[model samples]
Target: MHSRSERELGSGFPAVTTPLHALTLRAAANSIRAGELSSEAYTRALLERIAATDANVQAWAYLDPEGALAAAREADAERRAGAPVGPLAGIGIGVKDIVATLDQPTQLGSPIYTGARPAYDANCIERLRQAGGFVLGKTVTTEFAFIHPGKTRNPWRAGHTPGGSSSGSAAAVALGQVPAAIGTQTNGSLIRPAAYCGVVAFKPTLDALPFQGVNVFSPTLDTLGVLARSVADCALLASCLADPGGIPGDVEPIGRAPRLALLAAFPWVATSIEQEWAMHAALATLRDSGAVVTPVELAEAWHDAQRVHRMIMLYEGAQQMRDLQAREREQLSAKLNAALDEGREFGDGAYHAALARRDILIAAITEWLAPFDAIVAPPASASAPADLTHTGDPSCCTLWSLLGFPAVSIPIAVADNGLPLGLQLAATAGADERLLAVAQWCEERLAFKGLL
Candidate 1:
C-alpha cells in the first residue's frame, strides 16, 4: 500500500497549461525565491505530469512521490525560515539508475541487480540535494550502462528508440516529465540520446564531476552529463553540480565572426542523405550569419577511435562486472554477457597500448581544433529516432569523449519525418566554459534567424 501523502502528492497538482515546457533549474529557483510559486507546488506539478505520461514512455525506474514532495516541502520551509537557497533550489531532477541513490533502488537497468539499493547516494545526487534539489525519481538506463536497450521508448514516436544508456533521462526531458535529468556516457550515451530525442545535452570535460558511488562501466571514459531544453539550462545544471565558480574568464565571444571547422568525413560511420542535408543546412546558417566555415578532413588515426573506445570499454567493463558474471551469469542479459566474453580476449598489453594511443589521438584532435572556436559536425547518422532494439551509433561522439573534450548537442533542425536533428559543437579539452559561451551565442543567433 502507498502512503496517503504519496497518493496526495501524485494526485493533488494540476496539469501544465502551456505548450512550452522548458523549465530550467535556474528559473525554478527564481520562481521560488520570488514567491511566484511554491517549491512543493512546482514539484507536485512535475509529479502529476510524470504520472500522466510516463506509463507510455516508461522513462522512470523508481519514483518516490512521497519523498520528492517531502523534500520540496523542506525546501519551502527553509525559505520561510530565511535560509539561503542554492542555484538549483526546489527543482526536480531525475537520477540515472546507474548512479546510486540511498533512497531508491539502483538497478543499473539489469535484472540481476533487481531491488539493489546502496547505502550512500551518488556524489552528484548528494551535491544536488545539498543545492536544494528534489530527487524526482530514477530514470531508465541501459543494462550496466552498455548497449543493452531499456524499456523506454521515444516520446516523439512510440516504437522508435530514445537512445541508450541514458535513454530515460533523454526521453523524460523531451516529453517534459522533468525539466532536466542526470546522464552518464562512456561511449556516446549522453550526446547520442540527446540528439535522438531533440534536446540539449552537455558532456563536460572528462572528470569534471566526481563519480563516486556511481556504477562503473568504463572508468577512463565514463563521464557525467546533463540533458535539458536549452544550452543555458544545461550550463546552469552543470555549474550547480560541479560548483565551478565565476564561469571561467577565458570564454571570449567571437567579436567579428567565428571560424568553424566542419568534419566532412568520418571513417567509422557514414552519414545518411538526410543527415548530410541537415549538416549542410546548419553550416549554411552559420555561414550566412557572417561566420567562416571550412571543411576539414580528420587524420586517419581518428578512424580507429571507435575500435579503441570499444576495446577499453570491454576490458574495463569485464573487470567491473567480474563479480556479477561469477554470481549471476545466467541472470545477465545476452548483450552484457557477450560484451564480457569479448572483453576476456584482450591482454593487458593491448589495453595499455589503447590508452597510450588514446592520449596521442587527443593531442592530434586538440591541435586540429586550435585555430577554430569549435568544430561543427553531424551529431548522429540519422536526424530522428531509430528502432528501439539499439541506440544509434556513438561513433560521431567517440573521438571527442576519448579526447576528454567538451561537447554539446544543439537541436537545430527537424527532419522531414517531423523529428529533430542536432548540430554538435566540440572544443578543446578543459575549455568547457568557452565552448558553452560560444554555443549559447550561436544558439541565440540561429534561433533569431528561425534556423533552430
Candidate 2:
C-alpha cells in the first residue's frame, strides 16, 4: 500500500508527467476555452489517471475511453470552427450510476437492473451535455442508492469505507480521476461520502437541479448534488445544470463576515474523538477569522427529524420500487429487502402524517435559520468508518435532507487516521446561492488542503 502522502498526489500510483488531470474543473475549462489546452488532451489525461489507479480505488462503474475521446475531439472541433460553445465546454464529468445516461448502462448497483440502459438522458445529464461537458462514465452507487455498499474503497486508506451511496462519485473526484461528479442524496448519500473522501459536495435546494430520468428512490427527499475538488467547481457545475444561461456573473457580494450558527448537538449520533477535536479546531479558526460563531440548538420540532425522514423515505421508496419488490425480491440484497418489507408496513395515513410533520419542521427550521447565513455541523458522525460492510452514519445530514434545505460539505480538518473531516453548512430552502457564497467564505477561512 502507498503512503497517504503519495496517495494525496493524485492517485496512489506514481505521478505522471504533465499531470493535466490534476487541474481543477474551472481551470481546465478556462484553459480549453483559451486554446491553451485541447479537450482531447485533458480527457486523455483523466482517462490515463483512471486506468492507472482505479484497480484499487474502483471508482468507476463504467468507463468509455473511446467514447470520451470522440466527444473531446468534437468539442475541440467546434471551438476551432468558432461554433458557439457552452460554459462547461470540453469538461469531463462522472455521473453516478443511478442517473440515466443513454450512452451508458445504469445498473443502479443492483442485479435486477444489470446492463440496463436508459432510453434518454436524465434532465441533469442533458443540461450538462448541453453545456459542452461529456460523460466520462458512471460512478458506482449503493444498491438502489440505499444502504448497501459498493466496490469503491476510500482513496485515503484502502480498508476504510468511502461513505455511500455516492461512494464512487466522491472517491473519483477526490482522486482527480474526474474533476467533478454528480451524486444524489435522499439522505446522507452526497454529504457523507464527500466528507469521507475529502472533497467538496453541494446539495442544492430541492429540485434546484432537475431530477427527471434519474432513478427515483424518494421523490419527497431525493435531491441531485455535485461533488468536486472545491466550492467554486461545484458552483460552476451547479449553475450550468440549473440554468443554461451560463455561469452567473456579477452576483451580489457578501459585504461582511458571515453570521454562522454552530450546531452544538446532533441528535442520536455520537461524535468520534477525531470529530470532536476537529470541530473544536474549526470553531477556533472561524472565530479567529472574524466570523461570529454562535452555539445553536435545534428547536423542539426537529428532535424527531431523523425518524420522520426515515418513515417518509421508506414509505415512498417502497411505493416507487413496488414493481421490483414483487418481481425481483429474491435478487435484491437482504438489507434492501428488509427495508422494503418494513416500508410496506406503513399505511397511507402514516405516510401522510410523516409528510405533514416534515412540513411543520421545515417551517420551524427555516424560521429559526432565517437569522444566520448558514448553520454549521459535522457532515457525518465521524470520518469514514474503518469497515466496508456499512457506510458511515447519516445523522448529520438527515434533517437538512428532510427539509429540502441547501447544504454543502467542506473539509475543515483531517482526522488522526488520515481521513478528512468535513463541516456541513445548511441554509434555508431557496437559499442555495447564499449558501454557496457562505460555504466558499468558510472554506477560505478553514484553508483546508484536503488530501493534497
TM-scores of the candidates are 0.92, 0.94
- Alpha-carbon deviation at 23 in model 2, angstroms: 0.7
Which 10-residue window of candidate 1 scores lowest in summed lDDT? Answer: 1-10
Kindly report which residue pairs in candidate 2 clash with one another.
none
354-427, model 1: which lDDT tens digit per residue?
99989888888888789998888877888545587887788888878787788998877777886777888889
Best by TM-score: 2
What is candidate 2's lDDT per residue for 298-324, written digit by digit as tens? 766578998999999999988998988
State the lDDT at 7 in candidate 2. 16
Worst 10 residues of 2 by lDDT: 2-11
The lDDT, on a scale of 0 to 1, for candidate 2 is 0.87
Off by over 4 Å in 1: 1-22, 246-256, 448-452
- Against the reference, the lDDT scores of all candidates come to 0.80, 0.87
TM-score, candidate 2, is: 0.94
Q: How far out, in Å, is residue 233 in model 1? A: 0.6
